[model samples]
Target: MLWWGKEMNEWQVLHASDLDFLLENSSSPYDYSGDNNESEYCCGTPPCSQDFTFDRTFLPVLYSLLFILGLLGNGAVAAVLLSQKAALSSTDTFLLHLAVADMLLVLTLPLWAVDAAVQWVFGSGLCKVAGALFNINFYAGALLLACISFDRYLSIVHATQLYRRRPQARVTLTCVTVWGLCLLFALPDFIFLAANHDERLSATHCQYSIQQVGHTARALQLVAGFLLPLLVMAYCYARILAVLLLSRGQRRLRAIRVVVVVVVAFTICWTPYHLVVLVDTLMNMGALARNCSQENHVDVAKSITSGLGYMHCCLNPLLYAFVGVKFRERMWQLLIRLGCPEQREHVRQLSRRDSSWSETTEASYSGL
Candidate 1:
């Protein structure tokens, strides 16, 4: 889901021939008062004529790949999770919700993929729906990751079962609150996004369509979607690492490795996109000088980095679910119950081999 920046206010007043290049192709603020064929003046300087050939050819393929892989991975997670509803831990519950969020996020990809390759064939109403859906799930997924980190911190660092009593009620309440907050965050997308014809580009784009600085929405997303969750995960994982360091066991060592990988993978995937967003935010807020070259660079960087961010949905299942011994065992057991006799013996062997270490891992992170 692309976000609005301060320049949106100026874009609303632009003539059809002077409007930015295809807004649908960009994930950052659209460059206002520019034509694809000729440079136009904006911010007291001439804007660059951006060639979207790369975006048209590249983004669709990338989004399609992410959609297919994310669907299979997150779908397997959801299916396996639902089958074991009776034996879910707090961590399992969070994983289930995270999978749900990733699935929802990927479902919006086909529309966006189409938009990048072609244009907004879907009407303005569906545009708003797709944008809002993307915004909601994106924010919810990040927040749920933070919740998982906090739950891990409690389990490993504090060794407290805060949700042991009425766990379902507590977990449900927490997830519902996350969804509510995400819905609130998505309001601007529902309100400002629409399918509009860019005369210079000669295409209809589902993009932010208003004249407001819109810094509040950007700041909210930056903080709630990225910064706050990043801080929570960093602190929680750092504390958990400290506690694990004092212990001596193969399980502790394995848990430490998993924690390190999870944190590193997340940072690698998301930090670039948020950093680009932060730079764009500064540009929008006038804290940094804006130029045609810098704006073009930011837009290109946003596209590339945002693709990196989207891949995290595909990685979440591998990092958070498949990495856990208990989750794998449960999945194998579920397969055995579903008439997969081949997996029955495999499950037995796995259970026997992992019994001691798996229990400690579960006690430490509660089924990851």
Candidate 2:
């Protein structure tokens, strides 16, 4: 993973015909290169007023950066959480899953970066596997975020014992169930993504063509993965805010700030990508412009916003570190146990405060 940038360029041995195909139909990776005895094969698709070019060289750099940051941040969160799993809140379980999803997603990015710069050297099986993993993580992360928000809402706003007693079991099952659903949701990618070797380019590439699987998979992705999660998170956070406004406690106020940070960061990072994907879906379904210019814009928008979404993996662990005192406390404990002797005094102080906090109402205590 660390050496991805140097490794990605190792497969750039495009054949002469591949170079010619790239030079001719440079705008699209999906452009077919098979022999067309008839000119009609070239006639129908609209032409762009100007060539839409992207710096493919930048992709490897960008992917490498995301891989590093996301691996570090999420790895820390996962390490801390995993080390002390027996005593974490339900919300942290969702967070752990979120970090896992992001980490796995970023793991596959080097493959994509290489594919973008050159072509898909990996075969059909790998293409399907990568695609399935990507979709699974993408949807799983979004769903996990919603689950976290909802858990927070139940804890803060409703103050329900339903989540407090044996919460670990419930949360564990929830995580497992969600993961299963995500895998099922990802099956379409496994079925749809197959190598369409462009003979002219002398390159094998996985294409997501409508004729392969129709629009059902994409539609489900938009509705179930993107739209539904957004609606659930929005509702959960809104109700949380409404309840917090009426409450008067330092912990509740801190919780309010954490909720705001989580929701706002989520919106900023993911909304644009969903919007672009929605537009692209609509275009593919003939609900939007199908002109070459419009397609180029949508493709560029998806690429840019997708990178922005990738940063969310890095952003999430930062959010937890900055906003969740319990998370930070756990991290501190982990670090202390890992031989941060200088912070032993801090751990003592934390233990002292934990007992005091426990004597208070569970809400106030848990709010910490």
Candidate 3:
């Protein structure tokens, strides 16, 4: 089964006039597949087949480090949240979901690294599961972050009686809805991800093939995975900043700073990855057909973009550690609880502060 129809005819066979016309009119004429027999379509020329090389030397090391750190960090956050007896506030609820998303996403890293190091030995079933989970976790995290920003904006700027009525329940329901949406969005990966053998590389790759409904899958990813979430996040943060500027208080300022940091970190980590994905999608669509010779450069750019994305997996845990004071206090309490009974009072006080901080801040922001 060929993805994107059989390879196109070679570029070299076209007369100079045709070539000139194509170059002049098309943005990316080289993106189309040419006949394999044509000199122009040969490896050394423009429109040449891409040589995707998997560099295995550092894959194992990188995966092992990320797996260990991501699990430990995110696990600590989950442990702290679970141990608390307080009814989950909206922030707590969102943080818990964010930690879970990060943890689940990192869980699949080892599998990907193994695929990078060797032929995808894990069969089609495993590939589909991994790919689906990866997309679900990624989109879920983005959605949760946007939700967090909106929650902050509501609590700070638009404080109304509506917030007081079952705030926790509403937040829980929102988180559930986000997860449900993410799962639906991820459905295509489960259906379309396949294991294919590349004869040239003598390796099996777990990739989305162009056959069948791949184009639909790509379009869905572009919209759901990137565009929609980004638009929402941007709007939420913009409103958040506006509100922060209007309401002046030390506590409000601190909260705004933390929220801004979270948003900026998310943007820094995800923007490049999405940009690369957009570029790759466009390239595949022949948007850059005339620039086929630029493929090598584009491939290099993609590598950098992907690397930045991978780094975000590690950075998320660090962000939580720094941003959430409750997280830090609880982590410390856990450690102290393991060592001495004398620290129990301190832990209790910290928990109390964690639970009450929002309510107390609520009154101040409520213009009371």
Q: Could you give the candidate ranking by lDDT, starting with the highest?
A: 1, 2, 3
| Clash count list over all predictions | 0, 1, 13
Candidate 1, pairs of clashing residues:
none
Give one digit per residue, the lDDT tens place, for model 1 in 243-346.
Answer: 77777565876754554566677778988987887897787667899776887788778778889989988997787555667668877888888889888888
Candidate with the larger TM-score of 1 and 2: 1
Q: Which candidate is the best by TM-score?
A: 1
Q: Cα RMSD for candidate 3?
A: 7.2
In candidate 2, position 40 carries an lDDT of 29
Candidate 1: segments with Cα more than 4 A from true spot? 1-13, 16-44, 211-214, 253-260, 320-322
Q: lDDT for each of the candidates? A: 0.76, 0.68, 0.64
Residue range with the least summed lDDT across 10 consecutive positions in model 1:
1-10
Best by lDDT: 1
Candidate 2 whole-model C-alpha lDDT, 0 to 1: 0.68
Candidate 3 global TM-score: 0.78
What TM-score does each of the candidates earn? 0.86, 0.79, 0.78
Q: Put down candidate 2 lDDT per residue, 52-156, tens digits, no spaces.
A: 146265566788899899999999989988887467666656767888999999898888877766777788788789888988998898888788777777766
What lDDT, from 0 to 1, does candidate 3 have?
0.64
Q: List where candidate 2 sits over 4 angstroms from the true fold.
A: 1-55, 199-202, 209-214, 345-368
